[model samples]
Target: MSKLMIDSFRGFRSFELRCPGHVVLSGVPRAGRSDVISALARVLLPESRTSPTMSDLWQTTITAAATGDTEPGKDEESSDGQPPAAAQRLSSVEPRPYANVEVTLTDLDPELEQLFEGFLERCGPDGCAVAEDQALPGAPWCVRLAYRLVYDSDVEALEQFVYYPLASNPTAGKYTRVPASTRRVLPVVMLSAGRPLQLRAGSPLRRVIDELDPAAAAAAFDVLRSRVTHAAEELAGHDAVAQAVGVALASGGVGACLTDTPLDTAQVGFRADDGSAEALLKSLQPTVNLDAAGPLALASHGSTAAAMLGVAEAIMLATAPGAVILADDFGDQVDTANAEHLAARLRASAGQLWLSTRRPEVARAFDPEELVRLTRHGGERTWHRLKRPADRGRIRAMRQLHTQLLPALTSPAVAITEGPHDLVVYGTVDRQRLPGAAPLSAAGVRLVAAGTGQDGGIGEIPVVADLARSLGFRVIALIDRDKAEEQTIKQIEASCDVVVRLPSRTAIEGAVLAGVDIAKVRAASATLTAFLSQDPADGVPDVKVVEVVKRSLHKKSLHEPFLDALVEETKTPPPMIVDVLNHVAAAASPSYSGPAVIDIPPIPLPSAASPS
Candidate 1:
C-alpha cells in the first residue's frame, strides 16, 4: 500500500517540499506541525542529537530522583516475568542517535561558504567541535547546519556551537578546528503562537543571570524570585531602550526588579505547563490585548519580543547560505499587516520554507503558485497544489454558466420532459454545466403532467407555453416529432429553445437510458410494415432502390403495417392531428432541412404504449 506520512516525522520515508515553494500546512491543532518541524530540526542538527530528545534541559534534581534508587546489579523487579535490570541496562547503554535529515550547507546556500570558513577557522585546533570528525582521511570538513526554538532562548542558541565539529582528530586526542573550507550549512526554525501572548521572551532569568557572579550563575537561576512590576520605568533613563524593554515586560509572566526588588507578573511566564518543546510550539496561543487598543497596542508588553524573534529567523536565513526555515505560526491574530511583513521577509530569506496557514488571503500576500493547501481524505491528510489558469475567458464562461445559467434554470423554473429519462438526463446535464454545479434532482423540477390525451405525447409546444404560464418559470422542453406531431411543435416554439429534435423518434425513456441519439432512430412500425410484403419464410433482401428521374423504382418488401395504421388513424384523430400531418415528415426521407415533423397524413391518435 502506498501511503503518505502526514501526522508524524517518524513516519515519513523521504521528505521533499516542492521547489521555489512555500508550503501552507492548514490542519486542525494536534495535526502534527511540530512533528514535521522537529524532524527537520533533527536532520539539520544531528550532532547534538539525544535520546528522549531535549534531555539536556532536564534538571539534575529530576534526573536523580528518577534513577537514584535503582541498583546497578539488581534484577529484582520484573515486567512480564522479565527482570527490571534488563530494561534499565537497555536504557542505560548509550545508543548512538542520528539526525532526521542529513542536510548539507551546499543544498541551501552557496554564498555562505565564506561565513562557514571563517567560523571553522575560529574553532582552533583543540578539536572542541561537538561531534566526532570522521570522514575519508583528508576531505573538505563540513559542519551540520540545523537549529530550532519554540521561543528565543540562550540555550537554544548555543546548540549552534555544538552542531559542527569544533575541534578534530578524536582518535589522536588532537581536537582542533578543521579549516573553514569544509563546513555544512543548517536550517533555522522559530515557532510562533497560535492564540495569544504565550512566548516568554524577556524573562527575569536572563537579567538575573547577567547580574550574578561567574560562580553564582547556577545559584542565581535556582534562587531567582518571580515578581510582577509595572513596565513604565524600563524606559525612564533611556527613552528608546525603556520603551522596548517595558513593552517586552508587559507580555506577561516576567519577574522584574522593581526599585531593586524583583516582581513576578502572573500574566506571563515561561510555560509552566507540562509538555515537550514540540508540544509547546504546537499549542502556543497568540497574545490578546484587554485594552481596547488595536492588536499592536494590546501586544505592547511582548510585542517587541515576538517581533524581534521573527526578525531573527529572517536574519538567520538571510545571513546563512542554503538554509531552510519552517515557521509554524509566525504572525499574531489581530495584526495581519505584520504577518504580511513577515512573509515579505521570508521571500528575501536565504532558503525555501514550508508555511502552514488557515488564511486564504495569504496567497495574495505571496506568489500565487507558492501556496499549497493541506486537505484531508478519509483519515489521512494530503496536499493540493493550486495552479494558476492561463485563460481568463474560460474562467469567466464557467463562472457565468454556474452562477447565472444554472440558477435561472433551477430556481422558480418548470422542467418538462417528454418522458421520465428526459427529466433525469436534463437535470444531470444541467448540473455539469454550472459553476459549483450541483446535480438536478427530480424533486427540483415540476414535471407538468400531460393528461390522458390520445397519442399521450405533447409535442414541444404545449409543454413549453403551459409551463411558462402555470409555473411562472423559465421552461425547457424536449419534443418528439412522431409521424404527425408538427402542430404540437409549433405551439412549443414560443417558450422552448427547442435545441434539437430527434430525427429517428423513439420513446424518450429509451433515448435517455440507452444513451441513443434521436437524429437517427430506426422506425419500428415502418420497418415492420415494409417486411410484411415479403414471405415470412424468406429473409429480407439487402438492396437500395433509387427512382432516378422519377421513373418506376421500388424498395423491396414495402412496409405494410405503417401504411395500414396511418390509413386507419386518419379517419379518427384528435384536434392536434390537423396541425401534425401538414407540417411533419418521415425521418428516413433525405433533405431534412426543416425541424422534425409528423407528416404522416392524418394519423388518428392511438393508445399510448408504455416505454419498452
Candidate 2:
C-alpha cells in the first residue's frame, strides 16, 4: 500500500491519500484532481518529460516570495555595498516556500526494500494515518520518496529535486537526493490525455520498452545486422560503387582511412553496429485494424487512449509488475464501451492504480472507499476520503450513501437529514424563508435523508456527513435533537461544514410553530378547518392547533393550504430555520473561508405558539 501526502502543490494544500493497491482520483473538472495525479506520477515516472514552471508553485509559495520575509541565501549587494535588485530580493527570501508530494510505500517487497534500504524508515500503524480512527496497518519496511520544488534563494530560481523524505540517519542534517540511476529504475507508468500511448521516446510506453529485457530480442537484432553487413559488402564490390570509389580516391583529400582496407574488408560498409540495431528497435509503433480500414494508427483520440491501456497492462506483466500506474482525464476520448472496459480494468488492478476523470461513467466504476475527492475549501484544494464499509455505523447509513452516490459526486453541497420528511422540511424552509433565492439549490446543495434515529442507531447522519464531504460537497447534517446525541453530534461535526441541531429535541413542524405567533397558529387552524368543510372557528387550544398542523404536515389535501396559511400569517420564521438560512448563505457565497458550526442553543423551546 502507498499513502500520498501532497503539500502546497499546485492547488492542493494538505492531506494523505491511502493508495490501497487501486486508488482512484475523481472530482469535477478543475477541482484539482489531475494535479494530484500528476504529482504522484512525476515522482516515479521516467519518460514523463515535462518541466514544472514557477507557475506550478502553490499560490501561497509564490506569495511568500513576493512578501520578502528574509535576506537572500547568497548576498547580491554590489561591491559598493548597494542593495541587491528589488526582484532578486523578492525571490531570495530565506526559508523559501516550496511544493512537495510524497508517497509512503508500506510493506515493500523484498527487492525494493533492499534497493532502498538506505532510505528506509518505519511508519507505524498509528503514525501514518491522517485521522486516528482511520489509522491503517503500517509497514515494517517503508520507503518514502518525494518530488519537490524549492525556491533557490541563491540563484533566485525555483530548483527541482527528487529525494528520499528522510535522511540516512534521523539526526543527520543532510537528506539524500535519489541518484539518477535509482530514479531511472523506479517503476511507474503515468498516462495522460496530452500524451498519447505509443512506442515513441519520452512516452510511458517507450519507457516500458526501455526497461524490457533486451536479451529477448538480442539474437534477432544480431541476425538483422549480419544480413545488412553482408548486403553492404556485396554492394561495395559492385562495378558502380568501385568506379565511384576510384574516382574519389585519387582526388579525395581524406581517403587514407579506407585506402589500407583489404578486398575482404569492404572499403564502403553499411553501419551494422549494436547502437544502430538498438536505435532501429526503439523506433517502432503499433497499428490496429478495428474496422474495414487497414491497420492504421488509432484514428480517434479516445480509441488511442483506450488501446494504450493494453500496453500499460504489458508494463504490469513484463516491464514492472506492481508498477505505479496513473491516468489523467482517463476517459477523455474513450467511447462509452471502451471507457467502461478501461475503467473496470483500473478498478480491478492489484497494483497501484490512480486516475482522475470527470466522466460519470468512468467514475462510477470504483467504490466510495477508493475515491479521493478534491474540493476547494476557502480557495485551497482539500482531499476527503470516505470510510470503508466496515467502518460505518449502520447498514442503513451505507444504503443512504449508495442511493445518492452519483448526485453527491456532482452536487456542490449536500444536506443530510434524519428522514425523508426532514429532507422535504429543510428544502421547504429554505425556499419559503428565502423566497426566490432558494439558497440550498441556488448554492447547488442536494438534500438526502439519513433515515430516522429510531432504527437502532444514529442512522446516516455520520455516514452521509462523511460520504458527502468525501465527494467534495459541503455537508450540512440537519437532524432532530434525538438523532444528534453528544457522541454522534461530535463525529458529525468533524465531517460536516455546518452541523445544525434542531432547537432541543424539536421536530421540523414544532420548530416552525414555536416561532409563529399564537394568533397565527389558531388562525391557520380555522382557515384549514373551513377549507375542509368542517367547523370554521378561531382560538382553538394551542395543543389542538398543534395536532392540526402535524396531521396536515403530510396530508396532501390540507398540507399545502395549512403551510401556506402559516407562512402568510407568521411574520417571523423559526430561529433554527433562520440559522440554517444564514449558514447556507455563507457557504454559497464566493468568500466562504471555512465551516461555520451553527448550533441553535439547546434551550427550552416552546412546542407551539402559546403566549399573546
lDDT against the true structure, each candidate: 0.37, 0.62
TM-score of each: 0.30, 0.57
In Å, residue 19's CA in model 2 sits off its true spot by: 4.2
Across residues 23-64, which tens digit of lDDT does each residue of candidate 1 receive?
544433333444555544444434324553433221111111
For lDDT, the strongest prediction is 2
Q: Candidate 2: misplaced stretches above 4 Å?
A: 17-21, 28-31, 48-50, 61-96, 126-139, 168-173, 194-197, 201-213, 216-285, 300-321, 335-340, 389-393, 415-466, 470-472, 476-587, 590-612
Candidate 1 structure lDDT: 0.37
Error of 2 at 142 (Å): 2.2
Instruction: Give a tens-digit lDDT track for model 2, residues 73-146.
Output: 85656557865544343433123268787887765668777788777776666334233234355536677777
* Shift of residue 66 alpha carbon in model 1, Å: 36
